[model samples]
Target: KEKVQAETFIKLVLLYNYRVERIKQFTNVTMGASTKEADIIVYNDDTCTKPHIVIECKNETISELEFLQAINQASAYAYALSGTIKYIWITTKSKNEYFLIDKDNNIKQSIPDIPQFGINKIQKYKYVYGGREQNQEAKKDKIKQQFFELETISEKDLINRFKQAHNSLWEGGKLDPSEAFDELDKLIFCKIWDEKIPRQKGEPYNFQIFKEPLPKNATKEQLLDIENKQTNDLFNRIITLYNQGKKEDPEVFKDNIRLSPQKVKTVVTYLESINLNITDLDSKGKAFETFMGSYFRGDFGQFFTPRNIVKFIVNSLPIDYKDKVLDTSCGSGGFLLYALNKIRLKADVFYKKDEIKHYKYWHDFASNNLFGIEISEKIARTAKMNMILHEAGHTNVISSDGLLQDIEIQKNSGNKEFKYNHFDYIITNPPFGSNVKQSEKPYLENYILGHKNINWLDPSKNECRDNQSTEILFIEQCYNFLKVGGILAIVLPDGILTNSSLQYVRNNIENWFRIIAIVSMPQTAFSPTGAGVKSSVMFLRKWNIQTTDKYKLIKQTLQEQIKKESCLKRKNRVSARSIEQPYPRDAFSN
Candidate 1:
């Protein structure tokens, strides 16, 4: 893409009447220990003795930080060259920055544009508005400028931009890492919102920097003030855009932009040019996931499930548009998003020719069928933002404990979709190694697995335990959320399956669900997330009402028959012992 950008810029230079022979692409220059390739180097004449300008072309989706790095790189190339290069031009397809370099004095100043071929004098800016309506006096000298439209970028580039923007906010601990992530999410939301706004082809975006024309004799102080004001104005626009998004979907974020004006500007600079609304759903979703995965793996790894595992679980399920799906411990919404993607791919097959129908088919599922619950408020918001980036399904993701009662979850989350036996599929990797104490959570008593000394044959003997491992309770919770015959794909520690002490848990699972499949995962499966426990992905189908009732009746009848048989045996043994003992005691003594 950078090579393509370079070629395109060369065409623009040629339009200014520069000779093709004088322009060189991939010109190598030595910078100390190694050589670097300059994207484009322009010479004053065909002789190519004097290097006039050094131009660096980058992909249009390049982040502001990368663009600046490119600028420095271009400068280094200029200094390395034997000839004195007077100007430096750095450009992406959508943005351009020009600089005037003084090598002897080691000074570089911002200039609107480098001079065109054969024009000894530089203008305040090149490519000014040139038509009958605007700047008529400069028509003869200035070239007509076209506005840049937002471009869709590749997933790799999008991820880089997200990471760069996030790093800039918290590089020096300006804000906590988690706080930085939140702020970055807010800015990205604003960027997407800005892209969705209706606009004509040539209109500029509200999120980008637009410097007003300044006086040629403007003082340094005056210039500083103008730049500061521009930053402030851009910050205000971001806030306005964020507010508008919040108004439409208030669940995405509850907090306002807390970064200083300058910090907000830094983030906006990276994202302002990309058209996130039109970017491929898979690309955007994965980009956000990758960016989030790296950050979360540091301090919040417990909340996140690896994408490979998430994909595996989602793919294994027979999910469709009509099925209401859920991730009880939906850390960053990995399962829900993957489920959404699955439906989207299905939509592509059925509605290949009809875009409108295709959109509705999958979008309806995202809007209505997908649901998630996250205990951490911050991670829940992250999950909501993750859904929003995927384009829908955010409203149903709630911040509350997955094991909470339906009413409590609904009340706490302000989303009424959570209910027992509601979801068609429950897919999640519930957090492991954590225990939910009966004292800490009153809802623990509500879970069958939460009890101690449970009698598989009788419910009356079940007593609530003081504490239960979370993974144990999540199984019951997933069962509660799933409808009869609903599918459940969950990740569990292997201890639950192999440990002798947890046979009761295994029994409870049998009572609740019919085992579908248990896939053994390697020890390293969760190592990336800082968990070393061996685990397995278990697929189960909940029992229907009739099946459950019939099983209970049969179990009760079998228990009664076994008890009767035991009683008869005991009576027979006692009769035999009494006859044999009397003969040995009283008769033998006589």
Candidate 2:
């Protein structure tokens, strides 16, 4: 609502040439038995003796029905101040209606604009570029001009716009909710690309609608042709921009925009005038996250890790700009984004006076240090989009099972960054309660946790199990991704910590890593996102080669001692049985 009010205020000052002092905000008017506040009231004089125009504003997200109600409300205000008020304007940021109040006739007539100061006749259009004057009287008054540039908005406003645009696409049931989300993502990408394009001051953006003055005597067919041509031109321009972005980062999207030209225009209308590139990064990130969380929590909730948990885990780690980070199950890239933001905050402190340096410091880290792997292709793309919305760090995120071998991950994702023992830190909240069957995912056989019998003395002797829980495999997968002595902060179910049956799994963790800390989380921690299992975040450091070798030798010695003890017990038992059988045979002979 503030966005609408600010926009209306600007248009009144710059376009209509309204004197700032003559315009009053939140002016109260007497109703039947009480009073109500008008959003904006313009007076004919600086003393505010006579009201000239009364304006009512609503948020851009207001429904059409609600907007009409606002118009009626504005008309009531006009009647309350009947004799003096000449106009009633109802507006949202994207839609507007102007009226000329015929107080004597008790009628309200639609108009293109309320007349400007010292003008008796209203113009056909409030704004025109490079056009002849509409009338001789209008020529006497100087026309005030303003240009549209992409503007930054608050987080609440941004989220509202996102929700409003997304609803406009799917509310008619033309496209399913998921398809609408994909189309919206594509259009938002195009909008951001359009904003980054170089342009001179006062130059219009191609992403917005351009009104062309048509001839008065034009045929109906000509008008239809012009409208179709305009839509086609806009669609072509948007596609060109989208293709350009895809050319730069081929992995961001794998499909062209599937929305019709009209649908595409609908999305563009919601996004074109906002400058996402210049918006505060934290605001942008949170806005996208809040919007995305609501959608995914209903459809792909298992892939989402609550933001509070993500922030908690990330904050507890000693991550730095120089550290190479990975989220094995990077669902929507929440952990990676938090890590990136952590580094960005550091950049702010280190490069306090230099804006370019500040951007470069964090941007370099995001481009070079962050990596992720997600099994679901759709969720992986969502993760990539999330990263892009946060400004960068998406190039290394790939769509592949986190448990896949490094070579297989590389082959599947076409990104060579998924190397064993390479990342400096691994942070993830792998999906819990899902069993990965060895038959279904052949890669599971390669994980020690996937084995039914694990031979700690010699890993090669381990027999592969038919199935294993995904969270267990993720523990080992995160270990594989981290370098020796590197950190792993993973969310795991409480069963892994206390279940006697998973002792071997615990033993494997002991052999491979040095336990740092285990922070138990409440069962309800993830309830809001649809996860209800009891969980904890375990922080571990991968053992160095020397420590791992020492553990292997210790296990070997223990296995040898156990074998020797078993042989001794068998020999003693045989001797005792033979002695007892000899005495029985002598008695039988007697």
Candidate 3:
């Protein structure tokens, strides 16, 4: 916990903006007659605009004692700045905590001090071409001049090619890649690089099936090989990328793998797990219940939660390297993976280049930092695939009912390693629905702390038991999974927030958690559901709702207290993949 020096502030600016030349740090400047308002004030820009960002550092030993000193200093500067600005970000390197103070009324919300260059920023990035020729056409023509070769590639080939491109670009000198390549552009790059046989469209998207999906009458060895390939490939790619990125950016490796929303779907559709007789289960085409509820009969409904959404939730949580993060509803462990991504991102952003050599020693801080529990076999497998994809396949992702508090089975008859009270952060979008049976009622209680006698502990009365509500169970499960001071960010249906059905429970739960910011979502966000339902994303955290006054305050004041939002126009958002066609052509079929 070194004091945040002049150099530390410069690093923060660099992370925020990619095209930075240098930073000038100022020191203990005078404030009012009684005291100096800030430890440091940094002036920087995002290339196009220059804005002054004020930061207060805790050069003193950062125990719980110095938290207030840094915060108080930040508050004074932000209060003064807000008189003319919208927001100011403040942080302390020792504790690694960052928060944004709203200038209007100084609403201070603690944000995790993550790396400035995160996957979210990468997604928002669009490449700008510049050349001596000067002008849009010249810039485009210049980039186009470099090369364009479409290597007729399989999904596996696409990833490998990206890996090669990644390594090549890193070696070439830390360049930012343009928006990800389309099938056409990738081929063009290959051709420009002198690959004579680039594949063209209207042809096969090659299948490197690890294990052949044998015919209906196929034998056992045929099945075994398919299973082997699926599992082995799943394991290899994650470690390779993790190690590769470590060697490359080592600090910001996770920052480079950018995917748009559509690209996210592309990767998940390609992520396959060896499920025995999975196709047979779809014979009836019956809709089975999973976390997100009755998805399609086959693999249509399951996709990894997009990285941007995960990044949003991860940033909202109060997490650090020391905090034990858990995802009771870890879908492909997307949330956990992103949380780890944030931790690593912060380490890269804040620590010095030389200090970063201690990357491995931070493994335990990153490894044991997350935990996940999911129930659906497909989702669990998908989560495993995602964790591996994100290179956190090793971060204990348990395949079990998230709704169940802790369903004790025979724990190998002698496992003393299970600890119940270790988690510090929880972020997830648990399944949404209301048709479960009472047989799983106890699990929901354990899941969301229904029996904890906290004022927020409100379960649907047994008199009208509707255990069918997976969303309700998830709410409970998340509440129970957290330590007393832990935080959570959950995305559930809008109904759960304002639905009159569980007003009592909602009111009670409000006491145990604080509803931070609710980002109302548009309907088109979800797929066509076999079970028709509406959805919205909610962000809340665990704490006791001790008094009825606090409950009434949150309820009555929510609407007025919430800030109105203007939705981004279509052009700013990601395009739908279905408007054209999806990957694996006939892969999600028989």
| Cα lDDT, all candidates | 0.81, 0.81, 0.45
- Superposed on all Cα atoms, the candidates' RMSDs to the truth, in angstroms, are 5.3, 6.3, 30.6
Candidate 3 yields a Cα-based lDDT of 0.45
Candidate scoring better on TM-score of 1 and 3: 1
Write candidate 3's Cα lDDT for 392-440 as tens digits: 4343665556554342511421212224444677777777654556564
The residue-by-residue lDDT of candidate 2 on 1-590, one tens digit each, is: 87789889887887567899999888888778889988998999879979999999998878645876998988888888744888998977755667777676666655545666656655433322212233333446556323334568889878877887888788757678877877888888888777777765444566765544344455556666766765677788899999998998788888898988977766766776677888988898899999888888877888888999999999999898999999888989999999998998898788873588898899999999999888887788888888888988788998887888999889888888889989999998888889998789999888878887466655567688888998999888888888998999999999999999998889889899999999999979989888788999999999987898899789878988988999999999999998877665467684
Clashes of each: 0, 0, 26
**Predicted candidate 1 versus true structure: per-residue lDDT over 1-590, tens digit per residue:** 66655555665565355788888878889899999888888898778889988888887656657878998998898888887688888876445667767676665666545765666655432321111233233334555432334667889878888887887788757579999998898888888788777764444577765554445556667666766776787788889999999999788888898999988876765676677887988899889999999998888889888889988989998998999999999888889988998999998899873589999999999999999988888888889888888997688988888888999888887888899999999998998889998888888888878877667656578788999999999998899899999999999999999999998789778777899999999999988889899999999999987777777688778879999999999999999998877654466573
What would you estimate as the lDDT of candidate 1?
A: 0.81
Instruction: Name the 10 consecutive residues with the lowest summed lDDT in model 1.
Output: 125-134
lDDT of 1 at 412: 87
State the number of backbone clashes in model 3: 26
